[model samples]
Target: MATRGTQILNPRTGQRSVFLQTAQDTGGALFQMETFHPAHNAAEPEHTHPFQESRCQVLTGTLRFRVGGVERTVKPGEAIVIPPGVAHHFWNDGEVEAHAIQEFRPALNIEDFFVAYFALARDGKLSDGGIPKSVLQLAVLLKAYDRVLRPTNPPRFLQRVLMETLGPVGRLAGYRPDYI
Candidate 1:
């Protein structure tokens, strides 16, 4: 079971997330949390979830989001919903920290994903931006998780092929599907 205050750090974006609810606590219905993202940092590259929908509500500071090719800035009390399979990315472009609540529907293994990702970062296995320095490591980790990166450079198809090819290598290197 996950507690209300379980926190995870994302070194790539310099954000700290506190879990407000977990899949176990909600019987797999939802996963919810508040993220404290540092200024001028992007939380993640554009990505998509094949099996989950997301809702984000800004609580403090300002957040910039690019959803389906449209970019916008959201402030306190603002919210946005991202349907499954939609390409989206967010960041805190403001001077102050950005606090926002994010919820995922039909929670899968996101909690575990966060745990493993943060652990890798803490172990110095990842770059300063929180990305694994090794391509194999990144492929293995991403393949084991739900979210898929949609890289704009090098074309999406090529990236997908690389991920598919490297996934098995990553597993062979002893990466598991989930950390929790």
Candidate 2:
């Protein structure tokens, strides 16, 4: 992987700025993803991945994060790795936005999953931390991105619910999946 890897081709594009670019993971994993500020609103919920190990590099902004049972902030230029089966969650909390890349093993098209999740969140049906104007507008932006990117399919009302939930956990639940 020359680092630039493939263009981020995932579902999260509907929200802030998320990318799941395929790359050469140092761990010799199946794919690498570059995403920005992945988070869950009230509707979005916490989740678990049964088999995949995850790694990330924080590019810009701050992310409210959790991995394996611990919570923390991953700052710019910093990187972290999450072992398989370890629960993890995160969200952005900066002025502009946050950028990060993740590595998933085997053949986890994490990109596709995020697209599904955000699409649901935008619809206002996915569970999240209550829909806010920012999130609602974010959903609209995501729909526009979908028109151009076409990541995944999630209903509109689900998006509405994801927005209504309490925190980033709701949005993330749909993204993480069984990797084993």
Candidate 1's residue-wise lDDT over 12-108, tens digit each? 6688999999988998889999889898986665677667888999999999999999999999999999998888888999999999999988788
Put down candidate 2 lDDT per residue, 9-117, tens digits, no spaces.
2233223433343423443345555665434321123444545666778887767777656888888889888766665667675565677766666534444544444
TM-score of each: 0.84, 0.53
TM-score computed on alpha carbons, candidate 1:
0.84
Off by over 4 Å in 1: 1-3, 128-130, 147-160
Q: Please give the range of 10 consecutive residues that has the lowest summed lDDT in model 1.
A: 146-155
For model 1, which pairs clash? Answer: 12-129, 12-130
Which ten contiguous residues of candidate 2 have the minimum total lDDT? 144-153
Estimate every model's Cα lDDT from 0 to 1: 0.78, 0.48
